[model samples]
Target: MCSISFLVLILFSTNFFLFSLLMLIKDFCMFIEWEVVSFNSCSIVMTFLFDWMSLLFMSFVLLISSLVIYYSKEYMGGDVNINRFIMLVLMFVLSMMLLIISPNLISILLGWDGLGLVSYCLVIYFQNVKSYNAGMLTALSNRIGDVAFLLAIAWMLNYGSWNYIFYLETMKNSIEMEIIGGLIMLAAMTKSAQIPFSSWLPAAMAAPTPVSALVHSSTLVTAGIYLLIRFNILLCDSWMGQVLLLLSGLTMFMAGLGANFEYDLKKIIALSTLSQLGLMMSILSMGFYKLAFFHLLSHALFKALLFMCAGAIIHNMNNSQDIRLMGGLGIYMPLTSGCFNVANLALCGMPFLAGFYSKDLILEIVSLSYINMFSFFLYFFSTGLTVCYSFRLVYYSMTGELNCGSLNMLSDEGWIMLRGMSGLLIMSIIGGSMLSWLIFPTPYMICLPIYLKLLTLFVCISGGLLGYLISNVSLFYFNKSLNNYLVSYFSGSMWFMPYISTYGVINPPLVLGSVVYKSFDQGWSEFMGGQNLYNKLVEYSQLVYFLHNNNLKIYLLLFVLWITFLFSFFFLF
Candidate 1:
């Protein structure tokens, strides 16, 4: 089953990749519509758009998914439900593909909801408390996006069609269009984990590593970026663009900071994915849709490799994910370490690597664009923090003394896993340059001051040094985090974002529900409803029975009184 799945994915990926190239060369787009129903000059149609963008994205998603599934064979070897896991992953890929190819809002919603449901299942694959909580958070957070899509769909009815692509140019200043744009942005924000919606991404790491690689890299998170790219016209000249820019910038900074303070290896990587997502979103908001798409593709390559390497290490380390308990893994697992470091360098945008082609260009473009100092500062500082966390991760996991037991054994002996990493490893090395040349035939004209151009390099060096120094511990070193425990905890806990997303969102509603249960359901409602009505009916029935009871003495007394009253009335007249 695994072999057949892999072969089919590879076949489709190659075909799509070739077709995308052809479309790019010819500058052609094909829209296929099949009308499911028609009445009174109205038609319901399933529409597909075949263009360079959609085809290329589909190819990349399929390629990454195939490799991840291949890797999972070894990773999930001991699991009894391996077939179930594979099916879920395939379903996720299918949903993503549906989302990619469809130009209609109704179809997009179908794909959007599918992604959410399938992700929830994958997240809870282990059937544990953490997994369950993470799955719920993942599902609910995405439910927000799903609702946004639904609203956009309903609002698009004002335009008489669900095909938003056709109206992008004509509906520029319309209020309904603006509302739809805002709704799309809101949905994108949630799916991409920007700012307030950021908690769920890291929480979702409770899923298996292969799922992490697939979701964090290409399919789930990038779905929002792709949607925004498709609807870039709506956001280019709107207030929604500016709002997105601010929130995404903050998201970048927040994720980078959070990653630095994180100890869990997977969480740190998840945070890095969050940081990259912010980069894509912020750039997209700035109207550089192509650059955002470029970064999206490039990021998918290396991030997947990074996660797979982490998975290999964790698997051999008895399922331990804590970086503090790891060290000198490079000595035993040389191949995995080599691949891991390569991926890290790519993430840091090292020269000539996949990340360098997109990330470096993005930084240069941001420097050239007219933007606020706050945004400018965020772009550079986040870049630095990315390097900082990455270096810290490397120090804790690769460079120090072995922190585990003397009898511990670790090696890159999992050939299947290594094979999977190798495919992404090559892509991480060259995919950026390839994508850049293909996506942008005309180069961007970037003009910036020398100091500004050098800012990215400066931050990287400083961040790396800071990461190493902070992580370098001595035998008698004092723990400053304990002294400043509150600050440390807050910074380390993603600024309490998880608490805000979970408890803050849940507590008020729960309290209100309790109050309603007591004040209404149990209190006023009971009095005004069945019980009160029953008491009133009982009292009325008792009164009637008292007034008209069958008794001989009572009847005789009543008759005598009636006669006496009639005689007294006559005498008075």
Candidate 2:
């Protein structure tokens, strides 16, 4: 299965890569659609928009999934249900592909539902309580988006068709279309784990490492960005677009802060993924769909490699996910460490790396735009937090003493694992420039002041410095005072979203359900519907059992009278 998938992706990537490079592909004048149902001016059709965006996104999904499968061969070799795992991954890939090609709302729902369900299945693949809890969280969080999508479909019903591709232009002036766009942004927010829905993505790290790489790279979270990009024109000129821009910027800032406080290895990267998702979303919300798309592609390449390297390290470290428990392993596992560093630097938007080109463009564009002071500062502050966490992470995992244990047991000769990381490592190094040239040959002509132009550099440097200083300093001496205590703690705790989600959102419903069960299910329902009928039936059965008259004389008289009545009836007839 893995080999066949690999071969298929090779062909797909080659074909689409050339097509994307051909410089001739244009938007379709009329997309090919096949009707599934038609009645009274209403029709549901399977419509595919095979433009550069869909093709490019599909290629990345396939690319990431294939690599994940190849890497999982070694990562999951000893597992008892390896086949099941592979099949689930394949299902996820298919769902993402379906989502990519869909131009109709109904078909998009079909794919959207598939992704949510399959992701739930994958998240719960492990037979542990943590996996089950995480799976429920992941599933329920995404279910919100699923419901929003359905509502958007219902709203689209006013037009008598679900093909949103043809209606993008018409939606601008229509209030109903604006509402639909708002609902879509909500759905996208949930799918992308922005703000209120942010807790699930980190909890989802309970799944196997391969799942993490694929999800963070392309398939699951990107679904939201992909959907919005297709609908970008409608969102560009709406008030909801401003709302989305603000929310996405806050989400990016929040996640970056959260990553600095997180201790779990996979969770840190998961938080980083959240941060990058925020970046993509904020850029899209700002009306730069192409830049967001470019970042999405470049981010996928390096982020997947990052997860693969983390997986390798975890495998070598006996599944210890706490970075605090690891140190100086760079001396032994140089290959894995090297890949980790490359991916991390790319994530930090280092020059010449995959993150640099797209990130720089996004910053430049945001600077040129006339957004408010709050959003402008939030964008750059989030960028600084990114570098802060990266440096802190490096200090914890790669530098200092050998904290976990002696280095005598360390080894990093996993060739297949390294082989998987190598593919993305090369891309992480070059994907940005290749995509920059291909996607935006001419580039935007932005003329910013020196301070505005140097904003990102300033943030990154200041962030790096603070990261090193605080990471080296011991926190035990700092008294818990009102000055920095709340700020420090809040930043690390993901601004308390996890608490609000678990207690505020999840707990109230559970409590209500229990109360309902006790009051209605066990009390009123059982007494009225079940117990009452049961008591009446029991009484009737008891009376019948006793109806023979407890005496012999009574039975004889009744028999004689019955015989006499029978003879009379016969004669009368």
Candidate 3:
């Protein structure tokens, strides 16, 4: 199965790269129709991937796709349409490949839309009501981002450089570039789900574990960041760069808070993914593309391992998803539990683990960058929160109560699943420095090993302490609405339209959000304007008919004449 899946994935990926190469060749072979519009008269058509950014992105795409395919076999054993699943997954990978390698705006759009469509299908592949609903919401939210991206691309073509080659070539020209860059940044923020755009991610948890593993951790969620880093030249002078930094920092902060309150295990991971993506965005905004890509690599290894382990837990317990109901099974499922704990610790950036190196690098980048003091504080606070929640995740389901009714059993899944997860965990523990060396050329000593170890230890310990306190404290009970107060006002209530049937201790933001959504969706202006126009038209037509109420015979003659005119008009057509 591993060999077969590898072949399928590699074949599809190779096909996309080869096809893109052919297109590039064809563009080069064609005669140039040069008409001088500005500095250079060049045709807009182009396709090339002979660049560092494209190569790096393609490597990530290929690596993650192959891993997910291998992991999916064991996780999706009994599912029907396995072949179709693999096919769509390959298509999804290909779309992203096209997206990253596209040399022109039009080609990029083609790849972007293709990826989005295939991603939507993968989200809803389960064919259930919940999955379908989540899929629709996911698709709808992404479409909003897609609109912004399309508009930005259109703006780029119209007001800025005519050719993408020239756009890249002349990216340093400050003023004109910033305008285009700002639009792209707006699009990126929406696509990556920074702060206000983050609610859709938790909703997207309804997708299968492999889908969640690949898309949430490594591919779809990171596309925006990739675009930003790839076009760093365009964004250098724009205020959009600073905006991205602030938004990303804010997103990391809020996402940490949201993860703290989520009862569902996957939702917690989903929230954490958002936070991590935010951190990556922050790094990219600071012109730390090397650090951003390195973090991306490490994050993919650990997160995919974490998701697969969550999948095993959910599968073993008859599809139980709530982490609140689980506890104390660490002894029973030692392998799975051990692997999960390692991944979580790495995620929380424990020293000697993978997350420690990558996360510390990000912190270093933040400190060195020209970001504002307030922004720095936000990121630090969020880092503290991340450590808290990551620790909670380790202790809650694996260490605490373990009493998940009758279905709870601490046991490992098939060897295939274990093998996949174990490999990922090992990679996470060591993936950090390898990517760092590959990406970062210069070495600057940032912090002492002792201090780094202490930071990780401190964060993990504090998180555990917080979890213990929350579990024991009666009055200070945890709740998501209060934790994600802002999201409750926007995505959780407005976009989701959750019905409020009960009223005890309701969250104010959610309540206000629901009311606002109703007002907008059922507003009077739209109905009244259309109704009034239609009524006036009908009334005038009736009045005109009434004025001609002279004779039925005359009316019949006029109708016959009108039919003749219609026939003549048809004959002319």
Candidate 4:
């Protein structure tokens, strides 16, 4: 079943790629509308827009998803519910496709909600306490975005159509449109895991690695970026865009810093995904939507490869995910290590690789743009930090002395998994260049000072050096994290994001819920509603029973009083 799914996805991906190329060359777009219902003057229509951007993104998603599924056949071969896992993944892919094609807000909502619902199921697939918590965090965080989309849809109702594409140009300067744009930005922020919404991205690593590779790296998180790209016109010169710029910059910096302190392999990659997402959002907010899209596509290729490599290592390591316990893996798993390092280097924007094409262009553009010091520093420093953590990851996982038990054996003999990764490995090496040439028909003319041009290189080298030196151990070395526990804890714990997102966001509501339950459901509501009504009914029934129980003394007294009152009334008249 997995094999068949893989082939079908690959075939569709190839066709989509071809269609995208044709659309790009011809500069053509097709919109198909199917009317579902009509009332007097109103019509409900489902719309699908076929353009170069959507086609290209769909191709990338399908390609990555197919490979991930093929990889899963080996990674999850031992699991009893492997078939169910594949089905869930396929559903996720279908939802992403729906999202990619739909141009109408209502149709988009269907896809949007589908992504969130399916992702929650996938996240809790393992059915453990940790997985359940992660799933809840993932679901609730995404729910914010879902609500935002719904609001955007409702806001669009005033415009007389749900087809946002029809209004993008005319609504750019409208105040009402700005509200919709802000809601869309909020939606994108949550979906992409920017700022406060970011805690779920790392937590979602509780899911299977294949899901991480497919969902986190490309489809689910990138959905927001794509939506924003579609709605870019409304963001131009808007206050919401400015706010997004600041928030996304901070998000990028925060993810990089947090990844440096993290030890979990999947979590590290997850944070890296968040960092890249920030980069894309910041660029989009700056009105460079095409650049953002370019980075999104390029990032997806290598990031997926990175996750797959991490999965292979984890699989061989007997499900252990801590980087600290892994060492000298390059010797035993050379192929996996090679692919891992390639993906890592690509992530750091090494020249001529998939990431360099998009990342270097983005940096060059940022350097030339007029921006404040804070945004500028965030861009370059985050770039450096990306290199820092990536190299740090590479050092600990691949270069150090073997730290595992001597009796344990490790090999790169998972041929199926390797084959799956190999497909992405080739793409990671070439995908960026291919995407850049295809997406940007006209080259951007970037003019910048030599120092600024080299700034990225300088930070990358320094970051790489710092990353290696920081992780290197010597005879006299002491654990700095242990010595400065507070600092380490703060940084390592994602700057307390898990607490903020879970306990902090949840605690207040939970407390309110408890109070409501005690005061209302269990207290006044019960008393006034069911209990009070019951008591009154019971008292009335008792009186009636007493009156009918043949109580002769009470009846005689009542009759005598009535007769005396009547006689007194007659005499007075």
In terms of lDDT, the poorest run of 10 residues in model 4 is: 473-482
The parts of candidate 2 lying over 4 Å away from their true place are 23-30, 35-44, 475-486, 537-573
Stretches off by above 4 angstroms in model 1 are: 37-43, 473-476, 530-573
> Worst lDDT window (10 residues) for model 1?
473-482
Each candidate structure's TM-score, on Cα atoms with residue i matched to residue i, is 0.92, 0.91, 0.76, 0.95
Instruction: Give me the displacement of residue 249 in model 4, in angstroms.
Output: 0.8
TM-score for candidate 4, please give it.
Answer: 0.95
C-alpha lDDT of residue 573 in model 2:
100
**lDDT by residue for model 1 (449-553), tens:** 899889889888998888877777421267555677888888888889999999998899989999999999999999999889999999999978876988787
Q: Decide which is better by TM-score, 3 or 4.
A: 4
What's the TM for model 3? 0.76
Count of backbone collisions in candidate 4: 0
Which candidate ranks first by lDDT, i.e. highest? 1
After TM-score superposition, the amount by which residue 41's alpha carbon in candidate 4 deviates from its true location, in angstroms, is: 6.3
Q: For model 4, how does the per-residue alpha-carbon lDDT over 1-573 read when each residue is reduced to its tens digit? A: 899999999999999999999999899999998889999998777889999999999999999999999999999999998999999999999999999999888888888889999999999998999999999999999999888888888999998888889898987888889999989999999999988788899999999999999987778999999999999887778898889899999999999998988889999999999999999999898999999999999999999999999999999999999998898999999999999999999999999999999999999999988888999999999999999999899889888677777866789999999999999999999998888888787877888889998999999999999888777742126866568889888888878888989888778999999999999999999898999999999999999999888899989999999999999999999
Best by TM-score: 4
TM-score of 2: 0.91
Report RMSD (Å) for each prediction in the order shown: 3.7, 4.2, 9.2, 2.0
**Deviating ranges (above 4 Å) for candidate 4:** 37-43, 473-476, 545-569
